[model samples]
Target: MTTLTRARTGPFAADYAALKAAAWLTPARERAWERLQEAASPSERRGNERWKYTDVRPLTSVPYRLAHAGALPGLAEVKKIAPWDDAWTTLTFVDGHFAPALSTEPTGRVAAGRLATATASVQSLLEARLAKVQAIDEEYFTLLNTAFLSDGAYVHVPDNAVEERAVHLLFIASPATSPRVAHPRTLVIAGKNSQSKFVESYVSLADSDQHFSNAVTEFFLDDGAQVEHYRILAENEKSHHIGNTRVHHMANSRFNSISFAIGPAIGRNDHHALIDGPGAETNLSGLYMTTNGQHMDNNISVNHEKPHGTSRQYYKGILAGKSRAVFSGIVVVKPGADKTFADQKDLNLLLSPGAEVDTKPSLEIFADDVKCFHGATAGHVDLDTLYYMRSRGIGLEAATQMLIRGFAAEVVERIKLPALARYVEGVTEKMLPEFRLEVPK
Candidate 1:
């Protein structure tokens, strides 16, 4: 196995070289990196399937510098941005390195800590399920993360253990320097009959300082376990974010994921969920709000590999200014996965004439007995509705804002945690101003 010991010194060296130098690189990851180095740069045109709508030139233009391990965020500053209101445990990371003094150990049935400092027992558990949930071959960034993963959070909920408060993992990206990159990896394991909720948020300190956050989150749920995972990406507008989340559900298990992307100059999120056992259920929802010159993309897939599994996915985007948005969703039912139920929908509301949105929802089923459906819609807010609201004593801007809020209410209400739901509402309210929606007094 080839291990990465230090940051690369040259400008010509690929980003993978820096990654390889930052962490322990297994033989598999090394080989994957080699392939990435040889692969040709993707074309910027809209003909390519993966890069159909979003342009990749900005990401490929600059070679990102590795975030210095010495400039991690302070605990006092991180606490200010913590989004949830739970007495639950907390794990803090600065520039992708774990800060032990800033984080809280798990209480009762929950176990959370830094992966680099985890004991042999915890390491064994992680080793058993790390690469089992999702494949990292397709995307170069994921392969880079696998090749150079060093310090991040590790959480494990034992069998039948249920926590009253949600566990929070706040990843703080404070770049003391410019044009830096950090890869934060989180592994969450929910044991059989266990229940837990985890909230992961990414925030940056400065808007002009260019930073890249490439994060990967893996969730493994044992038989009959239930897990609700929420991810919020609200970084500076000048930053770039590339994130991938993989979820695996076992027999009779349930997994729910809600991801909100409200910031970043350019962001691409890939979500994958696998129903590996019978009677498993999965619910995936996402919301992306983009304004100005920002660009955001979301690609997701759900695989029903076993019989009698249920899956639902819905994604919505509100695009304003000249910003661009893309959403691609796919649901696949394999053979013998009979009686499986799957549905997917993607909707986009273009708030500006120049704003653009590209949405595609697909269903691929090999089983004849399965019920699967997919749909996509893109349009502007209803002028008639806005006019009606304005005539009923509401200002034009406030009326338009009310309609947009109502459009997102379905997905926001689907959030099971009351406190978290309200927090998300507040974030949505803050986003209205960017979309030119007036705040009603």
Candidate 2:
């Protein structure tokens, strides 16, 4: 693996200085700073693996100022986005720092809070697992995030402990002046026999401020543990987003994730899951809607390391205007990973002549006894389906809307949470209607 070095001095000189002066700096943070200092600066249309599908020139062109931690959002504003159900616990972070005043820590079974305020006992756990699941070496954005991370939320679920309510985390980037950057790191550990749900939301205050958000989340699940993770990205239209999510599943553990991408000038999501124990299972699904000149990419890799593990992934994208979308997924079965069942599929719908899509789905199985399959498809709406609906008395626009809603419904309906599923569907409806789709009563 190639190690990325940090930048000594350049356009980010003052930003680096401010990071060093920040009061929340930690040893790990310092290590990240040193690593980024050695890495080369970003450029327009760089063909690096991490930046291949998405060009980050616009983000690097502007100098983003450091957001003041003192100006974090108030409790009332945080609660506005909270889940309607009282059973769930909510945690809010503003400008990358956790706000305890706007959070609720579930009783006894779990511990949740800012890394800075965590006790030495909890910090030890974080230190042991942080940055252990994913490789951050080749990705410059991940390195940048590690270097500037001040404070973020942390959740730990003990062995055999079960929580009835889900955990909701909201990260808000509010910039008072100039462009701002926020790096939010989240770590989750689920012990054996435990079950939980995690929901994360990323939003920005200003669309034209040229903000950049780099986020990383790691999850470790023990035997028999079940976890459902949901990520909603609705940042400003002019913001740049680079996020990485890594999950490791042990024996009999089950992991599920749903990603919704609705906003961002440019977006890239890197997701990877490893089934290291027998009987482990995983399900990953995502939906992205892009318009105007926005760009969105989703790259996923699943590794089956043991026998009898199963995994499935499905992702869909709707692009209009001159927007572009990309999806690359790979499933690998180790030599001894017999009876591993894996399948992946990606579907992209282009709503405009100029919209573009790049999709590649692949499967690599070393074990003869494994069952794996992959498929990818990119095309515009089916005119036949539209004509059939119109023939049945449905308006052309209404028929078009129905087709899109149905295409997106396939993934959104899989969401187990009722409220969240409804919210996601509502968002899709609003965004899809703009593509000359008619709403069916």
Off by over 4 Å in 1: 1-32, 38-47, 70-76, 437-441
Predicted structure with the largest lDDT when compared to the true one: 1
Error of 2 at 27 (Å): 2.5
Task: Work out how many backbone clashes candidate 2 has.
Answer: 12
Q: Give per-residue CA lDDT, model 1, range 291-407, as digits (tens).
A: 999999998988999999999888989888889988888888999889999999888888888888888888888987888888889988777778788889998878778878988
315-334 in candidate 2: lDDT tens per residue? 99988888898898889999
Using alpha carbons, what is the TM-score of model 1? Answer: 0.90
RMSD for each of the candidates: 4.8, 3.5
How far residue 438's Cα lies from its native spot in candidate 2, in Å, is 13
lDDT of 2 at 330: 86
